[model samples]
Target: MNHKLLPLKVFLLLALLSLSQMFCGINIQTENPTADPGFMATGIAATLTARAVSITPTVTTEQATQTATQQPTETESQQPVQTEPVIPEAASISVSLDTNCREGPSGDYQKLGYLLPGQTAALIGRNSTSTWWYIENPKKPGQYCWVWGEYATLHGDISAVPLTTPPPPPIPIAG
Candidate 1:
């Protein structure tokens, strides 16, 4: 191992390790498993096996007795429960020009209906690139369609909009 090449060798090793981990879906657990950080990846292939433990009857009895004896205090019962405020996601867009709404994010999809200029529609979601917005079909109620984002003026935060799968085309009924 040349001293001058040590840094390069270390960098190459790290790069190879990262690439291998990414391809193999192997994640190294750096923190305690008990503290769930919400963002941690699930369905991990690795497993942690714990040694067997024996508990006496007296300890179990005492624990149960303690739990049974505990009761909610008057103050605790009177206090109002705190809840997170639900912030409604903005999912509405105004059509800048009269554009045909399609079943999917692309023009190749079947045209569901037309969104008139200056008309507003509830945005359901967007494609991967956010180039198109999937909105509720104004002409046909209960149905949803996609419109090009370039032709529409979004009123709210487009990032808040969810990604949704486009509905399947309606099968034609043969007369």
Candidate 2:
């Protein structure tokens, strides 16, 4: 007789006794068929509740994955680079402050005109000094004058051509 056989035999007997005790506590006095029906209904409801809880998270994850796969590809590819547009050739620019349009190139010059806010002018030329601009006054049409470059915005849509008529043909200096 092996000693291991003795322990195995004891374990088997203890398992059978525990199972019998469980059965004794479970529905053994079922002379009442009404009691059996209630026990069966409770077992069925508990099984359904356990199954529903186990399946809910799996169902939600699968639905989310399907939606992600179905999204349009074009939306991912169409992102544009954001940038400001370049100023057009005849684009308008603003004056920095209130100032006078002068009659000549220097500061002691006579004031030929004045410009108010939103006054649009034709940009003719930038002086060699670069501080003055020759502009055409639209209010007093056909009048051309020198404006401090600091005082006016070049109007968009006005040509860059010389504001005044082209100069007369060069005089034929005697040889």
What clash pairs does model 1 have?
A: none
lDDT of 1 by residue, 116-154 (tens): 764778888887788888888999999888998876667
Once fitted onto the true fold, the runs of candidate 1 whose alpha carbons sit more than 4 angstroms away are 1-89, 167-175
RMSD (Å) per prediction: 20.8, 39.5
- lDDT computed for candidate 1: 0.66
Q: In order, what lDDT does every prediction score? A: 0.66, 0.53
Question: By how many angstroms RMSD does model 2 differ from the true structure?
Answer: 39.5
Local accuracy of candidate 2 as per-residue lDDT tens digits, 34-137: 33555566667667776775666654454455321222222222244455554444634345345566555445566667655435565766565556666665
Best by lDDT: 1
Q: TM-score: which candidate is best? A: 1
Indicate the worst ten consecutive residues by lDDT in candidate 1: 43-52
